[model samples]
Target: MKLFLTCPKGLELLLEEELHQLGVEDTKQTVAGVQCHGDLEDAYRICLWSRLANRVLMPVYQGDAETTEDLYDAVQQVSWLDHIRSEGTLLIDFTGQTRAINNTHFGALKVKDAIVDQIRDLTGARPSVDKVAPDLRINVRMHRGKVTVAIDLSGDSLHRRAYRLQAGQAPMKENLAAAVLLRSGWPARIADFDLLLDPMCGSGTLLIEAAMMAADIAPGLQRKRYGFSRWTGHQKGIWDELVAEANGRKAKGLSQLEISLVGRDEDKSVLRSARQNAERAGVAEFIDFAACRVEDLEREQLPEGVGLLVTNPPYGERLGETQQLMFLYRHLGDKLKEQFAGWTAAIFTSNPDLCKVMGMRADKQYKLFNGALESRLFVYPISERRPEQTVREEEDVVPLSDGAQMFANRLLKNRKQLAKWVKNEQIECYRLYDADMPEYSVAIDMYGDEVHVQEYAAPKKIDPVKTFSRLQEIMTAIPVALEIPANKVILKQRKKQQGSNQYEKQSETHRFKEVNEYGCRLLVNLHDYLDTGLFLDHRPIRYRIQQEAAGKDVLNLFSYTGTASVHAAKGGAKSTTSIDMSATYLNWAKRNLDLNGFSQGAHQQIQEDCLKWLRMQRTPAFDLIFMDPPTFSNSKRMEGVLDVQRDHVDMVDAAMRLLRKEGVLYFSNNYRRFKIDHDALSDYVVEDITFSTLDPDFKRNNRIHSCFKITHKA
Candidate 1:
């Protein structure tokens, strides 16, 4: 008999090898399934033992399905009584319909009509369709005017292992899980490793699969029934013997298997589901599940031995959130480096660009499909020490070319020009380079030992090749001029941004350090957001906030990272209210206040939409308020869009309702094309403070931001 075994599209090779290992021979690989010559016993064994197959099918007939009548006629000729009883439940799974059939549903109906009509004619009773649990399943595939009808030996997809009663969002199919393990060589080398860990185990699919393999347990053992068991052609004696042999092997093998499996996830609900799934799979006692974030995952959680680590982390669905996910990749890399030495990791991810931030060089990579998304399983052999940084850190210091030398000279000139102002103002963090040469077109700033580089987005008219060439030169010139390692530089593109765009995270490294500016020691996170937690350009604004905050109540709106709030707290503001929507940065703000000894009462941090929060405050409460709304913001949390240029009057008026009789509201934004509507603010004394806000470093780029000090006309 010829058998057809179907698996996921990308798992054909692995499935082919798995089928061969299961004592099946003469296998030929095809598009979605493999065709092999096997007896009844071999087919039954494949259904029970083959972990990579979705369905084991027996071809009954093949003919033209170019039209609906042809599809019906082809299915009717398969002799329904030979495989299924007249009154038994049946299901027809049709695929690849022709132009006349149009879709799967219509084609399945046509095939079902023919089978039901034929069974009724033979025995005066037609089989009923039972979608939930069918006695027999008919497989139909129509492709290029051809049709192949087969009996599905496996009632449900083999991927349904019957173990997972609960799962996390977007759980991996069990067969795919098995394929991942096989591709990682875990099954053959289970004895070589002491344990297997999944740090981002959403529902323990990977861990459960690994445990079953290690214990030599067939995944099909726990399933209540297969389609063939109810079919008229099933050989009860042969299948019963295979079952007894599998059960006896599972019992003895599990008793002797010494390897352990551990699964950890950040979500508690999913951890519960993983445990439940493991219990249902009968491997609950062999695997341990825990709720812990990947960054917090440590080697101490494991037994004292090197093992394999496998994780399928959430691939960000949106491209804009690349920075946030990058943070996670780097953090995963950091934890793996800090611990898990002499182990191995198989990290599966669809975002390759984000994976680079992990900083681990893959020893091997395999392409696999997670449904339609083409993903890679990157295998890394963890070493005892951190691998060399991907970026060249200790490049040979060579003399600069003339153009680079000229660029270096201008940098020195800028440093010399700003030296006195920087010293007299007691500023430690400020911009040192801002496109000093048009060719560079990158701003370089210093935050202690770090170099933050922002490449200005070039215009469409400019040649991308030339722009990139200049960027490469700038990358080289910055380190040479600054005498810093290339790794010390954090490079990001600076484009026109709105809402929380600049402040939104890129990486999960959560890497923060203390940096000082104008007598204020604040925290800065370089590995996360597009902008470091501290805005270097806002050095003077923070200082101004500090100067005027004495003996006043302060409110900081859109208080990102709350640097301005820290200024107010330090300058002896009676009380401070810092509001922003992102909990990540708000938590950072709370830490900054603690670093400054202001974590205690009266310094409040509220997570709310600033505009909405401002509107609700009708009482004149704050003595001084700093309002730095983004030029444009349309966060989901907001009731409506916030365009500073269009909504400034209404927003300012709302803020004024909370302002004390003689209070000041310092309004600033980075909208380059902004012009204050002087007529709209006729009722207030609005002072243009953009020029004064710029220190010597930013004197050349007034368009970086605009500031205004608004007060009651009286």
Candidate 2:
């Protein structure tokens, strides 16, 4: 007889190999399943021992199904009395459809009609539909005008091992958990007495599955129900003998089992659920459950031996959640290196970018699925060399050139000079070095412990090879001078960006670092783009807005990441509106606001061309408005190109129209040669407050940006 065993997608090859190991040698891999030649005894053994299959199906009929009538006839070809009695309950699981049967519901209804009609005609009785528990569960699959009717021997999916009585958030199915263990090489590791640990083991799914596989316990041993339990053709004697054999094997396997299994989660409730689940699976004595954080994991948790640490941490789907979870992934990697050196680690996550900050190199990576979400499993062999030791080894060999030593001396002097002021102002992010020397034209800024270095574009007369050498010196000097590791330095080249080029992503590494700026928490990515989310030149201006924003309606135009708007909202603004042209920045702004306890209601973000939006306003509604248009932009998303130098008067006039009689509008830009057209805007009084808005870090480059204060003339 031929049997079809179904599993999740991407596991077809594994499932085929598993069937071969079970003595069913003739197997063919197909989409999400495997087809094999097996007798009744083999089928029974698979239903008990197979860990990756979702269902075991025995084909009963095969014929053409070009229409609904043809499908009914194909199902009727099966000998109904041999499989199920006329008075028994049945359920039909229909998949696929034809032109005549346009949907699965209608196809299933037609199949049910055929089965009941045949049974009633023969014995004057018919089975009623039972969705929960059925005496006969039929599966009908139609593909390309052909139908294959089969009896489902496994009622529920094999993932439903009847051990997980309660589940935590985003739980992994049992079959997938089993596959994760198998792929991580847990079976081989167990034979060597290597320990197994899951740091984020919610509900103990991975732990219980590993225990079952190690103890020779059948995955279906705890399951009290199956589709074949009430089928008329079920061979009771064969199934009973298999069960007895499995029980004996399990007893022997348990007596010899000596490997350690440990699970840890931060949530106490989930840990309780995990313990209960382990007990129900009859593996509670073999595993240890604890409520501990990954960052707190120590070397004392296991004996001194090479082991495996496997876990599926939360991979958030939203931008805000992803930013917050980056720290968690980093901590997990840090702990693995610090405490579990010489061991192997496997991390399963949906977001691959999070793996970049793991601080270790992966030996192997495999793509799999956690239900519908595509995910990756990365395996790493933790090296015994510590991080500090590696850093010291690197420093001893890398000698700085004369120019780099001079630049490093300047960095030390600047940091010492700003130390007092930074402490007095409670500033966590500030510029440590600008182009102090003519030879090196790079700007270095410190955001907490991380450093961002931007090298200015060299002149056409400069040699490319010489410029590259200078950049290398800067990279070496910054880390050494700052006493920070080389990985903490994020380097990028500064060049003129046209239109939306500045907003476009330079890389896909979504590593975000959180910094505190005057009691407000903000996220900045130094490597993903040309500009970090927060602008250091406009720091004082944002603080000015925050100081005067109490109970005022505020507006921020071209609000990239909404740093200014966040400051305004934190100042107790009555309402805030942030408008930008890119949905990416708008979502970024939303995340910034949400990070500071501001949500949907009084805070609004609109994705539109700021100039176009300003013209659409017909009424005076805002008391304070800040406009920081780009110097030049010809983005395709906008109605027209925006040249701040040429169009500043008109843009300011449109924005001022929405300001009340006593309201004030702050207009700023970075066009160094931009001069205000005084004659064009005689209705409002404008003051150039550029010098007042300049902070100490930007005082060296006085023309970095221009600021103004405009109000209705009295």
Candidate 3:
């Protein structure tokens, strides 16, 4: 028998390969579908076991239909009584093309009328139309005046898989989720890791799927029906035998398998749904489900082996603001750093900004599509080491002084001509002042492209409006001077304090603002000297974080306006906690939280030093946590320079104290050459989370931030 399998766009190859692997012969791939020749049993097996196919269609015939009469005649020519009995119910589905019969319903009606009329004329009885529960389901596809008719072999969408009796918010389709896992190289015979984890487990699709694969269980075993069973050619005895054989092949002693599989979510309802789904899939015994916040996942002992952690986190488009997502990614990085050492991690996400917040380098990545959204999967290999081993030290890779030198050299080459032109053209905001002194020559301002100026003078006095006006004027003329198109130019002015007391004016500088871009409203903010406006270097990290957050709770510490929180929430974190010290930043975090629709009780905002908060908290807390602190800071409210390197032990200990028994913490610091004091916390386990943090944009700087995961000793 010849059969055609349908799937979403770009997945035809995957399904075709799957069909071949399932023993179907002569498989061919096509746009939006795949074709293969097989026996009725093969069709049944494919319908049951193929993971990537959406629907199986048995093509009955194909012909050209330039008019409605042609379509009706073609439909009547088929032996309708062969597939549909006069007493049975029938339903017709039509997809139109460039034919004269353009209306889908009208075309379907014509086909239905022809079939019924043929049946009545031949047998003196007519089948009833049952749209909801039709005994015979026929599909008609018309494209470019060519019509192909087929019978639907699978009744419902293959994604149902009959495994999920419940679902989490923004749950992923089973087929897509399985495809991601398979693409990630899962189900190794000798698994490198003794565990699989989905921190944002949602309704536990990823976790349940992982567990089933680990146990070598077929996903279709739970499904009770297929469209083929209703076909005239269906052999009950062959299907029964196939089922028996599949049952005989059922994995024995899965309960005895040493691997640990777990999922965590903040929403109890979601967790409940996940539990139900797992039960229906018959893999309930193999998974551990928890209703917990992302900040509370702690590391549990495994059977003396490494494990793999995979997740599909929320993206800002579905869940939260960009800053909030960034905050979630940051905390996810922190949690991975704090826990799950000697583990491999893979995350699938669509948001670039959220990937930046993870603060880890991904060893591997793949461009993929999560439905309509283009996404990426980032793979991070966790290492057993001191947390500092994971930190990316800017000084070691490229010293700040060297960076300053490079900046100066570039400006010097362009400054003379620029300054001369600025003076000649009477360009305002020219290099009236320049930090040319070696100790202070760090700032450069340009008016027009011709005004290649450098400042050598210190800040004795300055004009704000006058400087801005000059810069704006230069911005307007630079494109013209450079012969660049107006649309190609981006002009922005640097904001500064207006008065001495302005520094004392505490306002929420990191509050979320909705900006229209790419046909959607995106939340962004500008505050802090650390480029709160954007962390262009962390784009990869945000993408990775979203991939991992599908059904997990996320914790973002040192959340810094909660950009990571936003990413995690968007990536589908059940809950998130964002912690920082500044009230202004906390308010900013709130704004980000609100913008992402995650400002509900599930997510939390705290204004406190993350270390202190960790110390005051209980253990077995977070599944994923992100901690990225300033390299140096001296606030009157706190102590001296807040060095991440010098204070990593206390910080790790505090975070671990709040981690769940099997959770992860991504501890990171921007301090260049920052080293971990391992001996100070010899009782804990640490793993490097640095290799996955590298971003292509940060090519000049290797160590964007050093990060590590620490967990309790197994």
Candidate 2 lDDT, 1-714, residue by residue in tens: 999999988788889989989999999999889999989999888999999999999999988889877887888898899999989999999999778887898888999999999999999999999999999899999999999999999988778889899989899988888888888887866655468899899999999999999898999988898889999999999999999998999899889878889899989999999999999998999998988977678878665677888999988763224433655787788788767877889898888877766778999988888888888889998888767776865674667789889889999999898889898999989998889897888899998899988778787687644665676678779888999988788777666766766666756779888988887899999889878899998999999999989999999999999999999999999999999988888998899999999977999999999888988898999999999999999999899899998999999999999998988899999988889988898889999999999878888889989999999999
- Candidate 3: where is the Cα deviation over 4 Å? 251-257, 300-304, 318-320, 383-714
Per-residue CA lDDT of candidate 1, range 1-714, in tens?
988998888898898888789888698999877989989999999888988888999999987769988988988888889988899998999989667988899888998999999989889998998898899999999999999999999989888888998888778888888878877778787767888899889989999999899888998998989989899999999999999999998999789878888888888988999999888888899888888887678788678898898888887775444444666777798788768788888888887766677778999998888888898889988887634542233355456677767777777788788889877877667899898677778888887778887888777687644565466566667788777887797877766687667776676776788987666679987777778888776778888999999989999998888899999989999989999998877888888888889865989899999888887888999999998888898888898999988998888889888888899999998889988998988888999998999888888887889999999877
- Give the range of the ten consecutive residues with the poorest summed lDDT in model 3: 493-502
* Candidate 1 to truth, TM: 0.68
Pairs that clash in candidate 2: none
Prediction-by-prediction clash tally: 7, 0, 116
| Number of residue pairs clashing in candidate 3, backbone atoms closer than 3 angstroms, sequence gap of 3 or more or interchain | 116
* Residue 326's lDDT in candidate 2: 57
- The runs of at least 3 residues in candidate 2 whose Cα sits more than 4 Å from the true structure, single-residue gaps closed, are 20-26, 39-41, 81-90, 96-106, 116-135, 165-171, 235-256, 265-272, 291-296, 311-539, 542-662, 667-710
lDDT of 2: 0.87
Model 3, TM vs. native: 0.55
Clashes of 2: 0
Q: What is the TM-score of each candidate against the true structure?
A: 0.68, 0.64, 0.55
